[model samples]
Target: MKNTKKLYYLIGILVLVLLVWMVNDTFTQPGVDDLEMEFQEVAVYRNENNTGPIKRIYAVVVSDTLWHEMEQYGKLMPHTKYGNTQVYFFEDIANAPEKINAQSPYFDASLNPFCIGKYEKKAMGEEHFSKYPFR
Candidate 1:
C-alpha cells in the first residue's frame, strides 16, 4: 500500500511540473504587444517634425540602381531625404517616363554616374501632391 501511494505522489508531481512548464511557455510567447510597440515607434518619428504640407513627390527614372541613385541624390538635396522622397520604379525611363509625369510633380534628374549601365530598380517614400509645380 505504501509503494502504491508513492507511485501516485510521483505521478502527481510530474503532472504539476508539466502544467507549470506549459503555463510558462504560454506567458513567454510573443503577442500583439510586441507589434504594437514597433508601430508606435514609427508613428512617433513620422510626426516629430511639423513642417509644410507634406508633398507627394516622385523621382525621375535612372539607368543605374534605384536605391544607389536615391541615396546619392538624397545626400545632395534636402528634399530627397528618405522621409521626404518617394521613388517610382521603372524598367526604362524612356519606356514609361510619361507614367511618372502622369502621377505627380516629378523632377527630371538622372543618376550622376551613368557609365555603370542598367540594373535593378526600386522606389521609396510616400506619395504626395504639390500645391504648386515641382520646379
Candidate 2:
C-alpha cells in the first residue's frame, strides 16, 4: 500500500511540472525574447538572388575600457595592405537591452517584417525567422 501511494505522488509531481512548463511556454514571447541584448549586432547580407542587401540588426555591448584595450591590440585586426576593424565605443545606453524601441505591428505578419514566431540570435542564422508574408 505504501508503494502504491508513493507511485501516485510521483505521477502527480510529474503532471504538475508538465503543467507549469506548458503555462510558461504559452505566455512566453516568441523570437525577440531569445536575443542576448548585451551583445546585439547588425549585419547586412548581400544575397546573390536579391539586388539589395538585407539588413540584420543586432546590439553588441562592451565595456568602455575593454574597447580601448581592443583598440590598441586591434590596430591591424585584419592585417592586410587594406581594410581594418574600427572599434566604435558608445555608452551602454546606446543599446540598452531593457529598453525596446520596437513597435509590434498588429500580428498580421503578412504586413510586417516582424516574424510571428521565434527570433533566434544572429549567431543562430536565419532559418528560424519567417520574415515573410510581408513586403
Candidate 3:
C-alpha cells in the first residue's frame, strides 16, 4: 500500500510539472506583434502542394532598417519539412512586390534596388539572411 501511494505521488508531481511547462510555453512564445519594429506585409505566396515540398515567400515594408528584427520576422513565418521560405523587406510599400512565387528570381529584377533586406530558408533547413543598403 505504501509503494502504491508513493507511485501515485510521483505521477501527480509529473502531471503538475507538465501543466506548468505547458502554461509557460504558451505564454512565452512570440508572435508577429511581438516584433519591436513597425512593418506591413505587402505580399505572400505558397505553392500549396501537400504531396511535395512547399514553398513560401513574403514581401514586407518596414519603417526602419533593423536587421535582427527582420531576421526575427522571417523566423516567425510558417515553414514545413523539406520546404523553402523566403522574405524580402523594403522601406516603402510602393517598392514592395505585390506578388511572388517559388521561381528563381522570385521578384522582378527592377525591384532589387529597392529591397533593403532578404531572408531565406532552404529546403534542407539551411538559413541565410542579408541586409542591403538600398535605401
Candidate 4:
C-alpha cells in the first residue's frame, strides 16, 4: 500500500511539471505574442523574392548635408564605396548592450571622410534601409 501511494505521488508531481512546461512553451514562442509593442519608424529596400519576411532594422546615421541632398534627390541614393555604416538602433535603448561609438577604435575614430560630422542618426523601423549618397 505504501509503495502504491508513493508511485501515485511521483506520477502527480511529474504531471504537474509537464503542465507547467507546456504553459511556458505556449506563451513564450517567438512571434506569438499578441501585445501591441512600439517600433521606431524608418525605411529600407528589400526584395521579397530573395530575402524572407525577416525585416532588418537599423539606427541610421547621416550628415546634415546628406539629408539635404536626399531631399533634393527625392529618394534614397545608395553608395557602396564606403561600405555599410554602423548606427545603433535598439528596440530598447535603455537596456541596450554597450556599444563602441565613433570614438572607439572599431569605428576608426577618424575625423576625415567618415567622421562624425557627416553623420545623422535615425531609427530604421521594421524595414530594410538603403544607404544613399549624401551630397
Q: How many Å off is the CA of 18 in candidate 3?
A: 2.2
Candidate 2 vs. truth: CA RMSD?
17.0
Ranking by TM-score: 3, 1, 4, 2
The full ranking of all candidates by lDDT, starting with the best, is: 3, 1, 4, 2
TM-score of each: 0.28, 0.25, 0.85, 0.26
- What's each prediction's clash count? 2, 8, 0, 7
Q: In model 4, what lDDT does residue 133 have?
A: 18
lDDT of 1 by residue, 11-96 (tens): 99999999999999998964423331111110001123445433333333444444444334323323423345333333343433
Candidate 4 lDDT over 1-135, as tens digits, reads 999999999999999999999999998764412223323323333223323222221232322334333222222322222233333223333333233432223322221233212222223322132343121
Q: Highest TM-score: which candidate?
A: 3
Instruction: Give candidate 2's total backbone clashes.
Output: 8
Residues 51-115 of candidate 2 have per-residue lDDT tens digits of 33232222223333343232332231222222112222223533323322222321223323332
TM-score of 4: 0.26
lDDT of 3: 0.89
Model 1 root mean square deviation, Cα atoms = 15.4
Q: Among all windows of ten consecutive residues in candidate 4, which has the lowest summed lDDT?
A: 111-120
RMSD, one per candidate, in order: 15.4, 17.0, 2.3, 15.4
List the candidate 4 regions with Cα displacement exceeding 4 Å.
25-39, 44-46, 50-135
